[model samples]
Target: MRSRRVLFAVHDWGLGHATRCLVLIRALVERGDEVTVLMAPSPGLQLLKAELGQQCTFYPYPDIPKPLGRSPPMFYAAMTGALPLIWARFKREHRLTERLVRKHRFERVITDSRLGVWSRTAPSYCIFHSLRQIVPGRSPAIERLVERGQRRLLKPYRKVLIPDFAENGGLSGDLGHDPQLDWGAGRLVYIGPLSGVRRQNVPEDIDYFFSLSGLEPQRSLLEQRVQAALPRLSGRIVVARGRLDAAGDQEQKGNATIYGYLDRHAQAEMLNRARLVFTRSGYTTLMELAELGKRALLVPTPGQSEQEYLAQFHHERGHAWSTTQRRLDIVRDLARAQGTTGIPQHATADSVQRFLDAIS
Candidate 1:
């Protein structure tokens, strides 16, 4: 194949989005394609920039921070109130995207969770595991409305790329959810789970491994709460705060240990060595733990319905366990739970390949 250019518009929600896209971008570059990663300037993006090398171009896109609220409805309402800013960001990013597309004549545009990057003029494909926007309660009417937007969102792109198994929507199939909810005929494609690190046969001797990531107050608040309860947790514990500014190193705190951050390699090393992993049950994290064959105690952010639903969804399947951020003591209960996921997979989620293949 001749050399081609591709623009990857990554979502700025959390580290998971850009972290997984690292594998995608590397795959494209390995296959002799010029790739540019356009996302809002973010700590996660900065982390990615450090690892992805200079061949990858960087462009600023919209970045949304986690909102603080008491409930899912309140959180969504707060986020919804930011619609004007969201639209403005998309407008600005889209204009910048157009300029890049025109200047570089990209052969294809691949967007991961970032909508509106799919342009009619250029071959474009969308990569996402979420379609119907997650909401509280299982209302068919709301699902239909979200399904409509999801379908419309699918229309601008040439293909829809999903990063989960085709069967049972991987781990997120249940809970009034359908991978095919808005997926068009022949347009929906699954590329396994996009994973950067494989499960190493390292020692699983450590106790509960907690990965705290969301945003400022929420993240710091969780840290303080966990730090207060640290005295109670038995065995060795590791709490990662996912801070981007400081140097990522290991430190011991009585029986508990804290790491400011961990790149993918260090993270995999730890996950392989951990007996149980704790974190928000986001779809990507769920798949990563599954692929790594690690048990987890999920603590979803209080108000984000997606994490809450995902936590419940996997909890029902017995793949992992879930608890509200408030009742983190359930982690003690989780210590009694045994491993659930059957086996580890060597597969990598090639959403990037599927999108490129679609455009080609």
Candidate 2:
């Protein structure tokens, strides 16, 4: 295979998108591809730089503003009002992509949910899981409209790579698998779970592992709540604050240890050793849980419909126990979660190779 100059664009919504892309990006680098990453100035970008080092070139690119609200209704309203701004950002990025592709002569373009990062001259692909955006009221009409709009946005990409299994309804459930949408034949490919965290043969000595992540006030809110209840919790507890901006300091309390953040390798080691994992019901984290076959207590971010839906989906399936951030009780929720079965184990060893093969 001839070495190809590839341009990868990542959405800076959260660390999940950046972390999941690491698997594919590392594979690209190992295969001798010249990879250039385009992303906004974010902790995710910083993480990628720290992980990839000199393996890939980094370019600072602006992404759409994160229209997060303090509550669910507000969030929906904000998103609806931000449509024009989102469209403008898309146009801006599309223009920038054209210039970048022309200047650098990139042979392939890949975007992780950045709608405007594709080029007409290159074989462009998108990495996305949510094909149908779940509305607050679960209105079929609204959901169908949202699905159609998403499909239109994805039309530029040669393939939309879903990081999930195609069988057993996959890990995403209704979020990725929508029977109503006409996903063009061979256009949407399920490339399995693109989790950077691999299951390791390590002792499950840690009683609990809490990996906190998500956007804005909600993330901070969760942190404050969890910190307040930490003193009441028992057993060997490990908490990753998911604070990418803060220093990676490991603080030890009586029976608990907390860190500002944990990188991929450190996170993987912790996950392997943890008897019970607790995290936000983000798709990326769920994929990691599936990969490691770990049971978890899921608390979805308020106002984020995707996370909320995913939490409920898994909860209903008896795969994991879930609760809202507002009603989370560390002791009670943890006990309930332990009763539920963990995610079914899946083979992700070939997921990256499958992705490469699909693109090739």
Candidate 3:
């Protein structure tokens, strides 16, 4: 392990993927391992550059977003449309991975769900959430085909790094995108939750930050719906607009104030101050929420099967309230949200330590 040269390849779909990788990379560096992060240029990537300056080298990976669409069906369609581009990217993935191995003399390749960012000549591992595909049954046969495709794509990796607990799948169910997919025998390792973010000054008295996800029409719809509904509530309200360029000083509209975008520090400030948070039911967001241990109203984007599943999953666990975004009635939603307790505070330390030990 002397003179270890580790390469971390991260997807650029959302800040979550890259952010999660940041935590792991930080751990690797702390252990005196020299690291190189291979990723696409993203806001999160820029943020990491600022945080991990000079500790590691960065190489660009051909990562792309899944595209933003308002509704789940539309977003999926948009993602489907990117199939051609994705395939082309995958082809480039193998080629780049091959060149990096010899050129950089890397000892390890750690990929956070990137298709082709590792090499055949080195010990490359993939970090991902889904082992089994979660198809909506619209095409059962197609789902099987997609599963096979995933298997084929991952076959070349030296190991598969999964972020989950040893049992109970840690944070999610077992059927679709579950632990059952860990068929790589001793080669598979559950690395717990992967998140590099550390929140400061978590407030115990605030309600919520009302985060707007970076996705498309759903983000706009939430803003409009929440603004329209805020007047009926009797409490402090702050909205994080999700887009930095659209950010500004809080604008008062009735009882609510909105900001275009909040930096990590700003977001931590809002999350700490808020009493009842509201956001979409993305798995990565759940990690952050778990860190905060604050109750929330989660409105999953319509038709995104995974989000829907997570909302319901957490709801059933008494961690948050899940409601469909379109059918949202904020008054009733908040009532249910306030009734539910948030996650345990110990969850954060448990999850982070698991990931650290995986690579240890």
Best by TM-score: 2
Error of 2 at 350 (Å): 1.4
TM-score of 1: 0.91
Sort by TM-score, best first: what order? 2, 1, 3
Better of 1 and 3 by TM-score: 1
* Candidate 1 residue-wise lDDT, 4-31, digit = tens: 8898888878788887788878878888
Model 1 segments more than 4 A misplaced: 64-67, 174-182, 248-250, 339-346, 349-356
> TM-score of each candidate?
0.91, 0.96, 0.89
**What would the per-residue lDDT of candidate 2 be over residues 224-276, giving only the tens digit for each residue?**
98888888888899999988666578889888899998877888999999999
Question: Candidate 3 vs. truth: CA RMSD?
Answer: 2.6
Give residue 100's error in model 3 in angstroms.
Answer: 1.6
